[model samples]
Target: MVFSNKQLLQKALEENGTALTIVELSQKTQLQVAKIRQTLTTWEKDIVRIGPQTYDLKWRVYCGKTFRHTPQAIEIEKGILSTETDVYYYLIASFDYRAKITLYDEDDVAYPLTDRKQSKNLKLSYLSGLSKWFKKYNFEVNDDILFTCKDIKTHEFKIRRQKKQERDEFIIAAKNRRLADLVYDIINHTLPKQEGDMFLIRKYVYVYPFNDPVPPDGLIKVLANNKRFLISNIDKMYSWTGHRIKDFLTVGLRKYYLQNDKKDWIPVIIDTDEFGKYGYCSQCSERVIWESDIGWHHTKTDFESAESYIPNEFFTSDNSKTRMN
Candidate 1:
C-alpha cells in the first residue's frame, strides 16, 4: 500500500542523531530533491529547514539549541507569504503544551486593532492587522485552538437544528387547531360590524366578511352546539332550518357570557324537545341541578356553589371509585 512520504521522512530524521540535508534525505528515502523540498516546506513543523537544501528534525538540539534563520523561516517571519490558518496550525503543531484559544469573526468588534496611521504604509485592513497584532502581543498558540473551532461548529449546528424544529412545531399547531378554538377565534375577530345574517360555510371558515354560501366540513357541528339556534335537516343545505328570533336573543347573551367565562357560551335555558332536560356537569358528570325552576334567568354567580359540580383536583390516593370531598 502507498504510505505517507511525510511520515517516512520524519521517521528517517528521528533515526539520525541530529539533522540531514535534502540530498541525504533523498538518498535515505529514495525520493527526488524536488519532492524533498516541497515536503520540507509543507511539513516545516516536523523538520526545521536549516538551509536552502539542508534539514533537521524540529526536536533535535545542539549545545544551546539556537534557532535557524533558514530562507523559508525568514520569509515566514517577515510575513511575506503565510496564511492565517496555516500560521495557527504550525504554532499548535510545534508546541507540546495545551493553550486556550478564542476565535472571532472578521466583523466582530472584540477583535484587536492597530492604529490606521501605523498600518497605512503596510496597507493592512482590519482582518490582516489582527495577525500582526497577535504576533506583537506575544500570544502562545497551541492545540486547544482546534478544539475551539470544533466547539463553535457544534454549537452553530445545534442552534440551526433547534430553530428548524420550532418552525415545524409552529406549522403543525396552526394546521391542527381545535374546532372549538377556531370558532372562538372567528366570533372574537371576524364576525363583521354591520350585520344582517352572518352565514359561515367551509370556504368562509376564517375568510371572514364573506357573503358566499359553501358548507365547509365541521361548520354544521358548531351551529348545532349553540343552543340559541334550532337545527334541522343538517345535511341538506336548502332544507337546513334555524329560529331567527331565538338566535338574536342567544347571540347577544353569548357576547356577555363570554366576557366572564372563556369556555363554550351555552345558556342555561333551551327547548326541552330538542336538548333533553338533563345537563351533565363537566367536572362531575352528574346531572346539573338548577336552584330555581327558572334556569338561565339568573346570572352565572347563582350556579357557582351547586352540589352537582365536581371539586377541583378530583383524584385521591385512596381508592378506585371517585368521590367528592
Candidate 2:
C-alpha cells in the first residue's frame, strides 16, 4: 500500500524502536533515495542523526502539575512517559514563581518545566538542596531550589556557556555539510567555484542583521571566541567555520534579539538575502523592518502578502544577491 512520507517514517520508527538507518528505512519504505535523504533532514525534531546514515528518535512524554503554591514557594510534579524504561518523575519546589525553574535530575540532565493540560497525581522522587546548582548559573536563590530573577542577558549568557560545545559542533557540521552539498551541485554542472562563491554561501547561511555583509562587531567577537567562525586572514570578512549557525538560523524564531530589547540583531532569510528582521503585531498584521543606521520602523505593508517590505539588492557594489539551488 502507498503511504505518505510521515506515515512511512512513523511506521519505520515504531518498528525500529527509536533506532534506524537510512539504508534500512529505504528498504522498508521502498521510497527513492533522494526522498529518504530529504525525509531524514526534514524530520530533525522527530529523529536525531547520531551517526552516518543512522538516526535515533527522541521521543518522550511529559506531564507537569502545579502541586502547591504559597506566597513563599510553589511546588510542581513532572512525569515522563517511556515504555522502554522506567517512567521518569520529579518534584520541583520553587520559591519564586516569576523566575522560571529548569529541573535537573541526578545525572545533571535538565528537564524543562512544561505545562500539561491533563495530569494525574504521581509519587515522584525529589532531589533536594539544589539551590547551589542555580546559583552556579548566577540565579539568586533563597534556599534549596529557590530562584529569583537576574539580568536576562546574564542568564542567557550562562545558558549559552553550558551548551556552547554542543552548539558549536552542530554549527560546524551544518556549515561543512552545506558547503559540501553546494560544491557537489556546482561540480555536477561543471562550474568553477569562485572565492566570491564561498562568501555568498556564508552570507546565505549567516544572515547578517545589517544591509552590508559585515555583521555586528559584538556578534563576530562572540562567534570568534566561541570558535564557531574564523576571521579572514586576507580580507575584512567573517567566514563561517560552522561554530554558531544555530544561533543565526534561529535568530528571530524565538526571542528575536540577544540584547538591546530585540533591536540589536536583525533577522533575514540566508538563501534569498531577504530581510526577515521585521514582525507583525499580534493585535494586527502591520509589518516592521529594521532601517540601516536607524532602528525598527513599522510600515503599513505586510511582508507575507507582499513582495518583500525591503528589496533583496542592498547596493550597486553588492552582487551577493545571487541565488543557489
Please identify model 2 stretches exceeding 4 Å from their true place: 60-102, 105-228, 231-325
> For residues 195-237, could you state the per-residue lDDT of candidate 1 as single tens digits?
1122222212222211112111122333344432222222111
lDDT of 2 by residue, 161-235 (tens): 122222244543344344333323332232211123222222222121112221122212222332112223211
lDDT over C-alpha atoms for residue 142 of model 2: 21
Go through the candidates in order and give each one's C-alpha lDDT: 0.32, 0.32
True-structure Cα RMSD, model 1: 32.5
Best prediction by TM-score: 2
Model 1 lDDT, residue 149, Cα:
21
